[model samples]
Target: MQYLHALETAIIYIEAHLDEDIGLEDVARETGYSYYHMTRLFKSAVGETVGSYINKRRLSNAAKELLYTENRIIDIAIYNGYESSEAFSRAFKDIYRISPLEYRKNKHDFFIGSKKGLNIDMLKHITNSITLEPTIANFKETKIVGIRGEVALKGNGLSCLWEQFHRIYAAIPHTVPNRRDFCVCETNQTTYKKNGDAIYSEMIGTEVDSFEEMPDFVVNKTVKPGKYAVFTHMGSLANLEKTYDYIWGTWSLSTKEELDNREDFELYTEQFYSMDNPDNRIKIYIPVC
Candidate 1:
């Protein structure tokens, strides 16, 4: 899709100019999109606004520099787009729950225990098994009725949310065909924690034609229409993290496409036999520009 291709171009442009002063107009111009159109398309596809993504990426890169280099805090801050050490410290503390100096001092211990340091052999094995290529798909606007919650990206928050949703899914009326279930991940504000955990709104639901006359207890959400990069995840649910690690850590970084700031979801189709079955398969749809 042209939109997806353009988005990828914008991401590449942003990444290359992270140390420079870049803005929406610059990115939109590079991708041949109007600022308004690009903003809408980007927010609908990537889940974070363009400005947010840039800021986060800059801060993330700054954090890495703090850990890996001997540069002073002010220099690191200025280099990453901040004008002053105090301003950078505030932003850094917001996401990482630590000042830049504190982060640098404890970086090794914190990162070593997190998902960022996945075992090389395990990552290779997971990447080897899954096809990293994604199919472009267009979806119409969809209305889903189900349970929603603020979930932590790490630990059992997602699993617990699904378990809760399953307990009441049967009572929700008027589900769509093929028993398709969706696990939509979205962001309300800040994306991640200092420890590398992200907080997002997770909705577990089935597609519905409309939201009218829904029960008071049911939460209704609309999935905006757009082009998506749909990748299939294979193997049991227990090992699903490995698949995601490869997608975000490996494939996304290598591809020309940039992740859209829209809702990314997991679609459970008929092929998803059971959580324990090694043959279980599910489709993961990521909005891309």
Candidate 2:
């Protein structure tokens, strides 16, 4: 979540300058991370780089405005910071899979979705080379008590959700260590909004010993055990997403194993605590064949 904070900060900045000519270097400097680092972090965490995400979002907004408002197509394009309607239309078509003129004539009848955009829950499997190091192992399902929040794939929204969780969990005395804390993210991309954000659950077990006090937490899920491709995230929250891209986009493509459709999760390598340096460490456990 801490690495997410830095990204959230960057997104907020991008939104403010949607109409201006913004550069990656400028944004990276503002966020105190290098361009390469920021790009990798964005890819790993959100599955899209900052520039691509912004372009798609801007074009989406422009398209919406074009249909809803009577503004000239060129005006709408320029307003959203595109230099030429031609340029805007090309980009818009690439994302929406339709031209702007057709879209406008339909009068907001349809919406454009991003092609380069990614699903937030899909785990990326990265390794130095294509090696099946016998990392697969069995895991029993876990039942945890925790609070939940809805989040977008990209936005300042998730950061706020974490803050809210901190507030709610702080009031509950049951969140202390030895009880163990669990953050569960429920993924349903069908309902995932334009922002690519979805609902996530933050849980602190009230009944670590048993399910006597299920409390307000949902007890409906039984996480299945299977072989998993594991990757270690070393140091700092910012680079986590890059690691994901390496695994999912690169390593998975090269390896013989195919990803198994199951709930992926972060395995706390050490005593994982957000209170500790968020960038410190964690393991992404992706179910695979």
Provide the overall lDDT of each model, using Cα atoms, as 2-decimal numbers. Answer: 0.74, 0.57
Q: What is the C-alpha RMSD of each candidate to the true structure, in Å?
A: 12.4, 10.6
Model 1 per-residue lDDT at 155: 71
Against the true structure, what is each candidate's TM-score? 0.61, 0.45
Candidate 1 least-lDDT 10 residues: 109-118
lDDT of 2 by residue, 145-223 (tens): 4455554444445446555655555434333355544444454322433333333442222223344544453342344
User: Candidate 2: misplaced stretches above 4 Å?
Assistant: 1-134, 167-180, 189-207, 217-221, 273-279
> Number of backbone collisions per candidate, in order?
14, 16
- Model 2 TM-score, 2 decimals: 0.45
Best-fitting candidate, scored by TM-score:
1
